[model samples]
Target: MFKKIAILHISLPIDQVYDYLEKRYNSTLYADASEQTKGYMPKIEIREATKNSFLSFYVKGHDPFTGLSVGSWKWSYTLTQEAGGMTKLKIAYEYGLFMSFISGGTVGHQAANEICETALALDALSNAQLAQ
Candidate 1:
């Protein structure tokens, strides 16, 4: 099993952050496509949502090294309002690999990759929000 957790503080209020993530989670990579067959499919499956607070989902996708779509990972995020009006976002992701042949690298490597990607995304979001 591989797992990773990340925390981010967004300057936006919890409600605003929640709304942004809600829309983002509902969005797909092929927004311009008119039909399902014509669109690029997204591997994310959102399982649950709690108004302005929490989200849980399953990501059916590939690890970078393996380059094969072979895992369904559980992911969750919790958002809380802080004293400074910032939103504290906690993210967790877990994947259990039953076969070693399918995993391209050590579990540590996979976890590190996941963490790096999550950090980069949060950084990008922070930068974008700051520019506004």
Candidate 2:
């Protein structure tokens, strides 16, 4: 099995970050992945989180390698108010692969790096949002 985790700490409030996620990545990716849930989607669900300080959801890998037969995954996040006029967003993603995919951590590290790229984009987006 291959496991990877990625996270980002944005300066925006938890609510604003959640809204950006819903408008940006949710429609194209998360919505399709979360077809099982109606009305409540990835970021929207964050509004109803048990703790107002955090938001979390999971998404599976659909890479050409894992394909359709592989298992699903969890990508959770927590947003917190920082001490020095900033906000922190923490993200975690985990995936388990088998057979040829589990041969090494090279692919897994690459996948994690890709996840980090996504997180970085989110950080940029938050910065833009804050600037506006």
Candidate 3:
């Protein structure tokens, strides 16, 4: 099993970020016409949550780099209200990997890197929107 966690602090309010993610869940996240073109975009199935500030979903898809089936796992995102009206976005990912030539440790590293990159991208978007 490979597990990774990424946290990002967005300047936007928690409600705003929560609404943004909820909207994305309703629509296709990648918006690709084909799965091949979608590449690493995981098929996400939203799960239940007690609060609007928290979201959970399942993800199953090919490894972003190797195109190998990585099985399925639960991904949870928590948006916590923070000081200055900022939001602390925490993303946790846990998934199982099929046996392959690649080591599980390597896969975990790659997954962590991808998570960090994704967090940075999201933070950038939040900053941009806040600036506007």
Q: Residues 36-94, candidate 3, lDDT per residue (tens digit)?
A: 56544555687866465788887665655777765566767788889998889888877
lDDT of 2 by residue, 1-132 (tens): 445664556666666765665455557565765555333343333333435355455443344453443444555556677665466766665566542264354556655775777677677876787788
Query: What lDDT score belongs to each candidate, Candidate 1 first?
Result: 0.68, 0.56, 0.69
The root-mean-square deviation over C-alpha atoms between each candidate and the true structure, in angstroms, is: 5.1, 6.5, 3.9
Question: Which one is best on TM-score?
Answer: 3
lDDT measured at residue 30 in model 1 versus the true structure, 0 to 100: 38
Residue-level lDDT for 106 in candidate 3: 61
CA lDDT for candidate 3: 0.69
Model 2 residue runs over 4 Å out of place are 1-3, 28-52, 60-67, 97-107
Q: How far is 29's C-alpha from truth in model 2 (Å)? A: 9.0
Runs in model 1 deviating more than 4 A are 25-40, 62-69, 99-101, 106-111
Output the lDDT of residue 50, model 3: 41
Question: Candidates sorted by TM-score, descending order?
Answer: 3, 1, 2
> What shift in Å separates residue 117 of candidate 1 from its native position after superposition?
3.5
lDDT of 2: 0.56
